[model samples]
Target: MLVLNSGSSSVKYQLLDMADGRRLAGGLAERIGESGGGGRIVHTSGDGGRRERTLPFPDHAAALGAVGEELRADGLGLDSPGLAAVGHRVVHGGTRFTEPTLVTDEVLEEVRALTPLAPLHNPANVTGIETARALRPDLPQVAVFDTAFHATLPEAAARYAVDRAVADRFSVRRYGFHGTSHQYVSRAAAGLLGREPSEVNVIVLHLGNGASASAVAGGVCVETSMGMTPLEGLVMGTRSGDLDPAVVFHLSRVGGLTMDEVDDLLNRRSGLVGLCGDNDMREIVRRREEGDREAAVAFDVYVHRLRKYIGAYTAVLGRVDALVFTAGVGENSAPVRAAATAGLEGLGITVDPELNAGRGGGARLVSPPGARVPVAVVPTDEEFEIARQAFALVGRSPR
Candidate 1:
């Protein structure tokens, strides 16, 4: 099965031969349809030799065509009869879909109806699906939602305290993002612990350019940091995670900023980059090492918010068996992990300096020996999880 993770500006594709459990091919087209239409796709084979190309890709459809050409060059094209189905990483499913769905005309329409909830993501996802379908009409296409796994969240956790009629009119509520990564990494952590998923309470921190924290009790998500949209959670590359709603009104009324400008501020000009003039973790750390006070403050602020959520989710879970970290920063930044879990000894959360910095493939515990609760770095595999569910739903694999 091949899984396609279509982002706002790129499409990441992986072709896996399930019969042999080998990745036949994979690649990505980045900076899609941008000015000058400059983009690149880096395709890799089993032996890890990468073939790269930079060319004009005016849109996602063109990008998909480029990807198809690359796969053909690698002799794993759509014509390969072994290719079962295409799995897409759709960012949101609202409350409608609880599992991966086979993409049909009706399903495509349903996804379009939910686009307002994810203005910046779902449309691009739909485009990718449509384009891929056009390229291989006979192939089964499946959509694995980023929000589907968190559909298990109860009313108390999912509800917003607004007038029911008003809220219902606008579909206002908590719809946590990163459900794919949280679900995948949390279960992987459970496996490492040698415990039944239902017996484990885990907190998963997916800290990439876009970040979220989720509290999973026994393999089910109970609470998560992201809500309604990806913009409502932890600090990100550009988006402000959480803020007072009145700030928008204030910005409009007093600061001479329009609502659109306010929206841009909150979404594109905020977060760690807005606060300290840098978004990447490595750059932030470098600035701090050079005695940049602004970067130091931003780092503290980021870790402080993360620690608070860790504490809050710990209380929500009553007892946490493990705290798992994944994504770009979560998996790579040792300092961030150390700072976020520091001073939580009372709650039995501790990270061993040596173990935390150690590396390996897949899931492994990073907590100090004798710690009451284990801290782990489980690299998230959303695409693999999406492919697994998509193939299962499409009957390409038995459930």
Candidate 2:
């Protein structure tokens, strides 16, 4: 199965051998719509063979065509009978799509209709789906939504405190993003604990450029940080996660800023970038070490918000068997792990400095021996999860 995660100007793809769940090959095509400079695609095979090309890719169709050529070089072309299906990472599914579905014209339209909910993402997903469909019309295409796993959220948790009639008319409710990563990491955490998913409760914190926290009770999402969109979660690289909604009014009426300007401020110019001048954690940490007060405060705010979610979700889950961290910052930033879990001993969460600082590649516990609740760093595999869900939906087995 081929899992495609398409963005506004990039396409990330992986060909997986579903029988054993091994990635056969993968590649990325970036800067697709740029004008002067040519785009780049880098393909790598399981055996470590690599091929890179720099060429003009004016659109997704052109980029995907180049991707197909590279795959053919690896004897894993989309037309190959061994290729089962194409699984797409759709950002929003609204309140309708709750699971991976075989893509159809209606499905595409529905995805397009949901664009207003995911203005920056769903359109790119639709483009990838369309391009893949045109490339191999005979192949089955599947959509594994980032919001699907959070569909299990109950009414009390999903509904906003706005007017019921108005919210319903506008579909204003919590539809958490990063469901794929949360689902994968939660299950993986359960496995690390030597327990069945149904027997464990997990708090998964996916801290990437965009971040979100989820409370999973017995494999089902009970509450998540992101609501209705990806911008409502923890402090992110550029996005201001949780803010006073009236700030919009204040900015427009008092600050003399337009809605679009406010939107751009919150979505593009806030969070770590807003707090400190830098958004990258590594750079922020380096600056903090060099006595940059702004970076220190930014890191504090980031971890402060993170710790708040941890406490809130711990209360939501009652007994969190595993506090799992995943994604770029979650998996790699030792300072974040230590800081987020610091002083939470009463809540059965404590990180061992030695273990937390260790550079183990795979999922493993960072908590001290026999800690009340194990703190784990589980690497998220959304592509593999997408491929697994896609192949399962089509009832196709790998060769």
As a TM-score, model 2 comes out at 0.98
Candidate 2 clashing pairs?
175-228
Positional deviation of 389 in candidate 1, in angstroms?
Answer: 0.4
Q: lDDT of candidate 1? A: 0.89
User: Model 1, residue 283: what's the lDDT?
Assistant: 96
Worst lDDT 10-window in candidate 1 = 390-399
Please give the CA lDDT of all the candidate structures: 0.89, 0.94
- TM-score of every model versus the real structure: 0.96, 0.98
* RMSD from true fold, candidate 2: 1.2
Clashing pairs in 1: none
Candidate with maximal TM-score: 2
